[model samples]
Target: MSRTTRPRKGAAHGDSRPAQAARPSPPTAETVTPDGPRYLYGIVRDTAPLDVGRIGLGIVPAQVYAVSEAGLAALVSVAPGRVVDPTRAHLLGHQRVTETLLREHTVIPVAFGTVMASEAQVRALLRTAQGELSGVLDALEGKVELGLKVLWHREHLAQRLVLEDAQLLRRDDEPEAEHERRLEAAVEDRAGRDMRALLEGLRPRAAAMREHPPVGERMLLNAAFLVERPRLEPFEEKVRSLAARSDTYTFRFTGPWAPYSFVDVHLGLRDEDASLP
Candidate 1:
């Protein structure tokens, strides 16, 4: 490969060399340009003007803003590379912006670190997903999602379940030592029945529900519910009722937030410079 030298501003026509040493390069894999890609936050209705402030990820100070095409609007900011680093600062920054949008508008939360090469590509995405995006915005209107994670105090809940259900008694075929060693598993066998009952009890209150795999050992249930604004109070009451029934459990509940789990549109674009390889 050959490198070409372009003259600096105000330099003579034939004088192209710099008066100083060349700048060192960034560590490998970093995008080395000011204009690499734009990070997407989410899609919002474009009917009203947005007052999003300057707060998005990048080495440069970026102003949060909107770009629209074919009746779709995306909230985006300048990105320093093809993908933003998944560090805590970047991830939390993305979340805080989405949290801010929930206060005033219906947002179709894009996955964190979503990036497009330029404003043109952002417009192209809007055009490609236009009809689907519009329909999602409509369906998600006046609706939000709530997340619930229920965890059992592993030892206490297992003991409680075993005490309540005679069927959970250690089997005659099972070794006494083994049953004593893994009493928690014996407890969970019965607890699964109660958990199923809890699921059935909560299903009627949600417009839609998505269950996630538990992340850790003590976690029993991880789920999100898409709920209408009008039913928000009823949903809260139901959650409280469920919580009341579980004396040996813990619940971490959040939201009344943007319908993040409910939106079906996917922009699975991995790279803007598709020709790079």
Candidate 2:
């Protein structure tokens, strides 16, 4: 008895008109540019061969490009986009480029995550920073940086300290927790003081030494020494003697790196200032 309207084809029961076709969404930033020139990393050097080929960092290609200055070079590659997210591939690529170059030549390695808008910018950096660049090159020439990590076997050293601190050890006879705590504290303090004195005694024999905070169960002393190539053997021998004399600690030496910690271009001005008459 009630009037009924005819249903429209290709439309929902409640729709007033035919439904429109679904359209594809616009492309995302990730999908837009899948491949392009990526400013990967750089190195400072007097000269690098143009023909050096295909040094691979993972699956990516490693290529070397020179900067505008006569004594600088930038190692770069074509990345998958302008965005490089510092993945393992990227970081290792940076290390590989610098390490490979250092094997044959002296290099002032830039820290990882260096990027440029274009190759021209890379060249301009070389041209503008020429003085600073030259200083880094000169500082690193004919010398190598060695890393020495001195670690104390804490259990051994602690036991020895306990023996040495007889008064503190005797206090352990008291049942009071507070006295036990104080004794432990005194033992640790004496151990730290003795270790520092030992490290200080070894400094003069080294070109430079730096002590780092203790890590984990071992006390770590991280040192970087600039040793002349010929003197490397004697330098190492000194380290071994120090280790052999002490049963409390062991030394782990890793070396001949690109002087990453020691090469400070700013330090070069000190030399220039002294030379001025």
Candidate 3:
């Protein structure tokens, strides 16, 4: 014990040899390479279907591919490397694929800009999130999203305002003066107030409503409603009545979307979770 032990040869004097680095996991076929394109996004489906020729994206030929897992399938395309950024064209393409499928089969639309390493990864995602995916698909089945936009013809409303406001209409007979100008302003103010009341009255009937900010001297009210297929006709009839009653506002309806605005697939995640993959 007193003799002690000799200094450890390799470990002595604070050996300056660099530490061994941890080896990274081997890359799989689906692993994204430095120059490889992103996988983008994944959709939910029970099984992948057979390849059905190439779909055309303008002049570019886009091949449709599918990945299945846990009774869910994802339809994918090869995105061009040059246009990796999510542009209008890319988003529209994503929507087009889902929309086309919805015409015949039920589909749960994936959020835009989803990419995976390979079909395997997509399958893995589906397997892990099977419950959520199933729920989403079930909810979206037999339902479509519709968009309605209400725009006011300001000139018409203003004219009606002047005609309806006795105080302002009487000003036209009086000599051009400050009182007439004040009267005109009051009439315009009253017209705006009345229009707002009408819009507010219609809010309850709408599933969701958003008033577009006044842009470049124009006013717009945009809304999206998730109406069942059978209810569409009645909804349109209500809209027609609203339009007839308010000639000042023009109603434009576009619909049968893939529930893009209503689908909430991130239910299981925590409040701070930002997992889009």
Cα TM-score per model: 0.76, 0.68, 0.64
TM-score of 1: 0.76
How do the residues 1-277 of candidate 1 rate in per-residue lDDT, one tens digit apiece?
1111211223111111222221222222222335457788888666544667666664343567777665656777767678678887677667667766766666788877677888668877877776777777777765678888888777787677678777667898988887776686776665788778887888898888998899898888888888866676677778788888768778777875566667766564455532100
lDDT of each: 0.67, 0.54, 0.53
Worst ten-residue run, lDDT, model 3? 1-10
Best first by TM-score, ranked: 1, 2, 3
Candidate 2 clash pair list: none
lDDT of 3 by residue, 1-277 (tens): 0111221222211111222222222233323334333343335443324342344122453555555555655665554642445666666666567656655545566666555544444555666677777777666555556666666665676577677865556555566787657665875676567556656655555555444454444446555666555555666666666677766766676766656666666623232122332
Best prediction by TM-score: 1
Off by over 4 Å in 1: 1-36, 58-61, 165-174, 178-186, 268-277
Q: 1 or 2, which is superior by lDDT? A: 1
Q: Pick by lDDT: which candidate is best?
A: 1
> Candidate 3, 49: how far from true, in Å?
3.1
